[model samples]
Target: MKLDVTRRSREAMRAYLAEALDGCYEGEPTISPIEGGRAAAERQLSNFDVRRYASRNHVTRGHVSRMSPYIRHGVMTLREVRDAVFARFGRVGESIYKFVFELAWHQFWQEVYAGLGDEIYADIEDYKFPPPVWQETLPDDVARAETGLVCMDEALRELYATGYLHNHARMWFAAYLIHHRRVHWSVGERLFFAHLLDGNPPPNALSWQWVASTFSSKPYYFNRQNIEKYTDGTWCRQCTAACPFDQTYDALAGQLFGNA
Candidate 1:
């Protein structure tokens, strides 16, 4: 159907979906800030910065390209993105290695999905540590962005509002849900899949597993100090909750996993 999407305003488009897909889709239809289509994708690609992405991707407010939605939707292909990087930055060396490696990691997940299919929905391996009985569903507080932790609450609000979350934020949120709150990794994976613009089953599931210690050699948890440093205390500065992550790793491990 050569439908002119431009004919309808964002509200009209959302209303159409709500009427057309009724039970299949719920909630208020908020548009993503990321634009769609080849033109937008190309523009974003043209502005790619390899060096800053490499150096700052670990931080919340990083220089990483927000190309995920375009790439995920096939408005741009992985090869196209990789070629764009090389076209601008020349052959991969120290500067572009981290960015290219990330692209490669994305491809690696795609390959794994192709090979394993639905098996990735289940735990790929056993947990590295004895795990507590985890909640089978995402908690109402976390889902509603009311989890008193400013970092997690803000991340959830962003995910709900934009269908996007910075990678570091995603990690922190997942760790908070899986380790701090003792929710199942699958619960978090499903929640992300439902909201993320770039949500792919392989990476989403496996990454959650990695955080939960079901696929990795160790569970990934972050302390208040790490969050404060990377986010430049953006969330911590205003947070008033009894900070659960405000402890050493050894303390967290012992408290979260000891005798579980």
Candidate 2:
């Protein structure tokens, strides 16, 4: 079989991406946010010890692998990444299990896309709970990252700047957009796809649906307490907004889903 590839210098690639993504980004990304190519991916894979995987959700700790872009764009394959993990850690027991499971999630989303085609963009099943009214357009506050909710705005800024977010951050953002803002899940889905380097349609859309309660048993909502606990109260201390998320889950559910 014949193979073809296009390669560009780092400067040329950066300029092209900046121009191509022009207005879609809110701010300039970190310099060399991440590198591409197989070598870089392999290096990242090699660094994936099991200790970090165990603490991946700590926003303060921030111990993610940061290799989704490579996997998404085919710079590396899931099989190779998995084999590398196994080679290092030996069997698929507790130590390497979580990391492997994360890899499996990527493959599961891909398999769903392969089976469902474009239908992944639509709701996969009836919503278990009533969702708020759906707005087709992305809210200006969200797009501009001026939502006043400190954690959310910060997460949006990070996404715009890095083309990536921690999975927990992504879930919180999606839940806020769908359940709190009442924007349609599709609107947030498209925005994420536009900004994320690892933005594959199936995972993005389905995950948004999961947050929105269309693909899961209930909508996902988070409060200020949870944010404070995970993010070390960084966003909360400096926040000026009225803090809509201060309420309990029941209070939020009541306010968000009143008589629906």
lDDT leader: 1
Angstrom error at residue 85, model 2: 1.0
Off by over 4 Å in 2: 1-32
What residue pairs are clashing in model 2? none
- Model 1: per-residue Cα lDDT over 174-250, one tens digit each: 99998888899999999999999999889999899889887788899989999998888989998999999999988
Error in Å for residue 240 of model 2 = 1.3
Candidate-wise lDDT, in order:
0.85, 0.82
RMSD of 2: 4.2
Query: What are the RMSD figures for all models against the true structure?
Result: 2.5, 4.2
* Residue runs of model 1 more than 4 Å from their true location after superposition: 1-28, 58-60
- Candidate 2: minimum summed lDDT over ten consecutive residues — where? 1-10
